[model samples]
Structure formats: C-alpha cells, structure tokens
Target: MTEPMTDLPCTARVPADVEAPDRILWGLTARQIAILAAAAAIAYLLWRAIGDRVPLAVTAAVLVPVAGAAAVLALGRRDGLPLDAWLLAAVRYRRRPRLAVPTEPVEPSGWGPVSERRPLPAVLRLPATAIDDDGSIAVPDTGSVALVVATTVNVDLRTGPEQAAIVGAYGRWLNSLTGPVQVVVSTQRVDLSSQATRIADAAHELPHPALADAALDYAAFLDELAEHRDPLGRTVTVACVAPAGARGEAVRRAEHTAASLTAVGCRSAVLDAATATAVVTAAVDPFAPTDASWPRTPPNDPVTAARSS
Candidate 1:
C-alpha cells in the first residue's frame, strides 16, 4: 500500500523566446513579412522602370546588391534589436545633444559682460519632475510612481505545495496590475569598512579577553576581505506607475505589491520618501555617498558653508 501524496506543484517548461514575436507565415513575423514584401515590391518597380533600357546582366548586378541588402536589413538583428531599429537608434544617438544643464532657465541680463564665443546650455528635462513626501515620484505629463523593495523567494528550498503557493501569489499580483509596473533587480559593491570599524571599536566592550580577541580578529578579517576582494549586495525593487493626479493610487499599489510579495515568503515594503530618494540617488550615482537628510536639496541651490558644531 502507498501513502497519499501530500503536495503537488504544477510546473510548466517556459521557452527562452517566450517574448519573441509570433510568426504569421513561413516562420516569419508580421513585421518581417511586411519588410520582405516592401523590399520585393521596390525591386519589382525598379525592374519594370529600367528593364527595357538596361542590359539584363547590368540590371541584375544593380538590383541584386540592393535587394540583398534590403533582405539582410529585414532579417538581421543587432544587440537584441532589429538591424533597422539599431540603425535608427544609432542615427538618433548621433543627433542627440551631448551636453545639457538643469531645467531651471536663468534670464540673461544685458548688463553682464558679453561673451559671444560661449554656447548657451540646453535644458535637461527628465520625465520625473518631483518626488512627493509619501514616496510617489511625480512625472510632468505622465503619472506618479511608487517604489516597493522586495526580497526574492527561493523556490528550490520550498516544498512542492509551497512553491506552487508562491507562484500563485506572484501570478495574482501580476494579474491585478492595472497600470505599468517595473521590477528592477540591481547589484552593487558592498563596503564593509564601516562594519569592520564598528566591530573593532566594540571589541573592547566584550568583557572577556578571548571574546575581545575574537572580535578583533573577525574585524581584521572583514577589513582584509574588503581590501582584497570586491563584495557585492543585491536589491530588488518594484515601481508601480499610476496615472496623473493619482499619487495615492500609486502608493496603494506599492503597498498591495508588498503585501502580495509577503505571502510568497518574501520580505517587502513600500519605500518612504527619504528611502525612495536615497534609492534613486544610489541608482543615478552608485559611487556617490548619499546620507542626506529628508527633503532632498535642489540641484540649482547655491552651496553655503554651515557653522561648525
């Protein structure tokens, strides 16, 4: 006699090219078919126009290269994008402004010393205009977005039923999305210098000499590890975008996301304003130190020396 199965997890093999465009005909996507059709039509038109005047050999020589080039451009891909799109992007990148200043425009005074040689700066305009006190990032024309930091759940460590539950919960969250959502996983270098320093400092307070020595040794080990090897830390964040004038909705979505993720054996939370700002700052300049107080300093504000304590 066999015992009843306690748990059964439904599993499916997901293809690597799940996001690939569906093939419409002859193993070609709709876009590819359209491109090929256009290329063929252009070749036919050229042949009709010059077939009578030019020798068959010369016409074939001219049209063959052009048609081949068109076919390659239609079929080829570069850097994960279609060749045509890549070319267009390269062109746009070449044309884009190389230098930009803050969005704040200063009215030039006619009384100032004339410097005609210097070029005027172009304004740097980003989609996000401001971050609200409630952690909502405001976009000028689009909408507000709220961020939620989440921990990953290890499905391999869980039982079949547990894995199924985790997957189901995650799917529910994905299905409930009414607006654009972005999940960002980032890894950055970890600096253990502060921890080492703190441990070294507290080593004296351990009471026993053996414990103190052990703490000191551990601190020294951390310092050596930090100096010789590059340690890394990973963070996962979810950005929920809500339509304009719906900042509260974005926050609610973030909270909902956090709650859903919690059910999957993952720790998650909606970031506060300061934490959100810190996250953004870290993303923008990963190497920069950013322990600034709440309500971030304006980029255009003048720097003034503060009185020493």
Candidate 2:
C-alpha cells in the first residue's frame, strides 16, 4: 500500500532577511533612526540661526537636498553594509599606508632631507599572531583558533528522509554553538601534473598488459585535460575560536565539532600545527608552493635569533 508523505521536522520556509537588523521604529533600524534624528537636529538648528536673515524659500531650497542626502545615507545599503558604514570603510582604506612590510618599521635618523626621507613602511599585522605546536592559532587580544577540515556531502542527491536527517543533524550543530564558529568553503585551481605523473609511473606495475596500457592511456588523457581545461578543487574547513586564556579548549572544540558533524555524513579531521600552517599559507597565496617552510615560522618569532651556535 502507498503511504502519504509526512511533514519534515527540519525543513521550513525561512525569510531571506533573517540576519537583518531589528526595526526599532517605522521599519528603520536603530542606526538609521539615529542618523535621521541627527540630520533633523542639524536642519532645525540651521533654520533657527537663519530665519531672520535668509528667505524661507531659499533656506528650504538649500536644506531639501541635504535632507534627501541624509535619508539616502541612513536608509540605503551598499556591498552588504549600510551606506554610512561603507563610506567610513572607503575613507579608512584611502587613509591607510600604501606600503607595508612584515618587519617592524624604524624611524629614520635626523640626518636626511624631509623630501628624501620616505614614509616609514607600515607594519603588517596578520589576524593570527602565532601558530602553537598543538595547532592552536594565537589571535592577539581575542582568543585561540583551531582548524578542522571536513568533507562535503551532497544533500541534493539524497532522498527526502535522508535530506531531512542531514538537515536535522546540521541544525543540532547550529543550536549547540556557544561561541563564534566559522565554516569556510573555498575553491582553488588544481594542478593535475603530479597526479598524471604518479599514475604514469605506476602504469607498468599492473599485472596485465591491457590494464597497464589502460592506465597509461588514462594518464595521457589526464595530462591532455589538464592542459586544455582549468580544474578546481573545493575545501571545507571549520574554525572554532576559544575565548582568551583557554587555548587548549579550541582543539577540543574542533574535535567535538568534527564528531558532531559526522551525523551529516561528513568525514573530518583536526589539522596539526604543521598542516594548519600550510593551509594558512596556501590561503594567503594560492600561487605559492604548498611545501614552503616559511609559514612554519610564526610572526614576531625570529628564527635566526633562536638558532644555537
């Protein structure tokens, strides 16, 4: 007998503006209200000062455009932030130093011409100050972060019940969050040269001549595809940050989060310090070689000074 479909416990229609700020008055946020109120106060003050000297029509003409601009700045959004915030960010970006260096900048000696003395290079400050031996990242004045790499599962291919189960599992993880957790999914260009080479090298080890020829053909095909097309790979990583003074807790949280996510059919593992360093380095510069040793040395920790004679 055919069974009727039942309601899914995990599925529901969520609004698009779930993260939108709460509307305090007349559908405007607190920030929007504050901006409008400030502009109104300024306009009122202008009117009080100019009422005797200036004509009302002329004053209105000058204030109308200013009022409209203030409304736009308060109500409009650009690049996911309010217009005022975006403008502030643009101003900050323009004011920041053009040149930056990894090493700390030293003040120039008082012996050179003012024009000849170049602007001191700005010290580059990375989000993470250091990578501990146990894989925790030291975030200056914030907390420690631990990275866990997880495999992705395709929910579209799953049946209705299976999809619901996966959703429920994911919901559990979301509900369990006490502190900040970031799930980063990134795609990068993949180089298939090494893979082709490995396959080609192992082609002769096959038992049958036909199998060996097939492997060789596959290797050649891979080389041709790689040359003709750009292949990309996706990686999913979860970064769990523990509060200040609880560095070790970050690692435990990462492992626990990995275990919790297993219900959704994702296989995950916590990255060790060396592997985490490599991952971070690769993210900063995708064109750089993966096995570079420079990333192993954390910022401000001079390798030369630590060397024993």
Candidate 3:
C-alpha cells in the first residue's frame, strides 16, 4: 500500500478530512448575487463599446464591484435588511485584505462606559382626580327662602262703587308691604278636547248622523288651536326678601313690621290667616302712650296711611 500511494484517489488517501472556509470570496444573498451579476454584465458591455478608447480590463475591475455593492445597499435600505452581517463583513475585509475574523471584543464591564453612566430625567407627581367635575372644592347653596302665592280677587264690573272699593283694597295691599315680592302673571291656553268628545258621544247616540261629523270637526279644530297656541304662556315676576339677621330673628322682625303696618288700619297678616292688628294689640299695653293711634278716616289707602306719622 505504501509503495502504491500514487495509485490511490485524493479523497480515499486523505480520509476526506478538511476544515470548511468561514467565508467565500463571492459570498452574497440571492438578490445581492443577482444584482452583482447584472452590474458585471453592464460593465462588460460598456467596456466592449469603448474598449478602443479606454483600458477595458482596469475599468471593469474598478467599477463592476462598486456598482454591485451600491445596488445591494439601495435594495437593502428599501427592504429592511439585516445590516449587522454586512457591516461586520465590510469591517473585517477592511482590516485584513486576505483573511478576516468576525468576533467582537468584550468590554471590561457589562455595558459600554457611556451607557453605564447615562442620567435620567426627573419625574413630576400629579393629583389622581380632576378639580372641575369631581367637585373637590366646597360650594355654598344659595336659594330663595319661600314662595308667597297671591289669592284670586273678583270685582263687580257693573257697580262703580264696588269697582272703586276693590281698586282701593288693591292699593292698600300694595302699600302694606315694605320688601321685594315677585308677581307672576300666567295665561294658559284653553283645551276643549274633553267637551268636544262629550259632544261627539251625544251626537253618536242621536238619530241624526250630521251632528257626529260636526263634533269631530270641532274636536279637530280645538286640537289644531292647542298645537299652534302657547299653552304655558306666563309673565312671572319673582320678589326675593332677604332678611338682615339670622333666620329666627328675621322672622320675628318681619312679624313686628307687619304688626306696625296693621296698626295704621291696613289689613295684613304676619304669616297668613292670623290678623296683625290683634297680634300688635296683645303684644303692647292699650293704655301705653307709645302705642300708635287708630286712624280717624278709613285706612283704605295704604300709601296715605303709611305717610301719616
């Protein structure tokens, strides 16, 4: 066997033992390889076209690889390519022309110096709930004390004396109070639907059929009027009486003022139904000189009675 060593095949004699190359001279991705081939063909065509005027060999060698690399770079940028391998390869190729090692050096610490000592920005604290809608701030409740609804009055339109008396009573009522009071005047639209319905029922029961149509027409008219008219039309003037002291003291003072007005022969009540005149008389001695005298003439006009000392 030793004497016939030259007769053996290369693989059989060497036992097929060999280390594979880490990188190939023409190492490239499928796309990169295509781009490089195209660039080489273009360079060859250009050289053939202008070979007589220029050095074709030198020009092809210099420009073909550069054009291929440029095309590859442009394609990589457009398509999100892995740049780490390419970059390492380039760096290795630059460092060692014939051979290259792709291993990166380990830093002394876990991370780089700049990354280890980077400063962080300060954080700001804010309240958990908002102030506007949350209603964290306290607010005072401000509303009217009570509403004084006026009573209805009817005067005899035919009798002049009765009308005058009613007018005089109203004048007295107006002058009796010394505070703000709201006067609400409301005018409501009339609805005749129930009346029309009653009429329709009556017509239906009757022998004649014409009345039923008339009743229905009347009902329709009434409904139309209601829809067009302002049902809740009103003119309300609100009067707010704010007392000077505490609630209890204010009520007492108001009662006293009402009594004083009644002493002048004006019809008034401290709190409804109870007469102020009796209240005033019972509160003070009848023989006391300080007590106000009863008016000789009828205190029908509150303004005149109020003007009297």
TM-score for each candidate, following the candidate numbering:
0.77, 0.81, 0.22
**Alpha carbon lDDT at 155, candidate 3:** 42
Give per-model CA RMSD. Answer: 5.2, 5.2, 45.2
Tens digit of lDDT per residue, candidate 1, span 188-267? Answer: 76667777887999999999999999999999998999899988778899999899876499999899989988987789
- Give one digit per residue, the lDDT tens place, for model 2 in 1-309: 899986554474546987788998999999999999999999898888887789989899878987999999998999989999999999999989989889998897778667665677899888888888888889987799999889999987877788888888888888888778999998876667667787999989989999999999999998898899987778888999999988599999998899988877999888878778877887898864242222365543556655678
**Lowest-scoring 10 consecutive residues by lDDT in candidate 1?**
289-298
lDDT tens digits, residue span 173-235, model 3: 556665644454544333345444556667677666677777777777766765676343222
Superposed Cα RMSD, model 2: 5.2
Report the number of the highest-lDDT candidate: 2
Worst 10 residues of 2 by lDDT: 288-297
Best by TM-score: 2
Off by over 4 Å in 2: 1-10, 13-15, 107-117, 194-225, 287-309
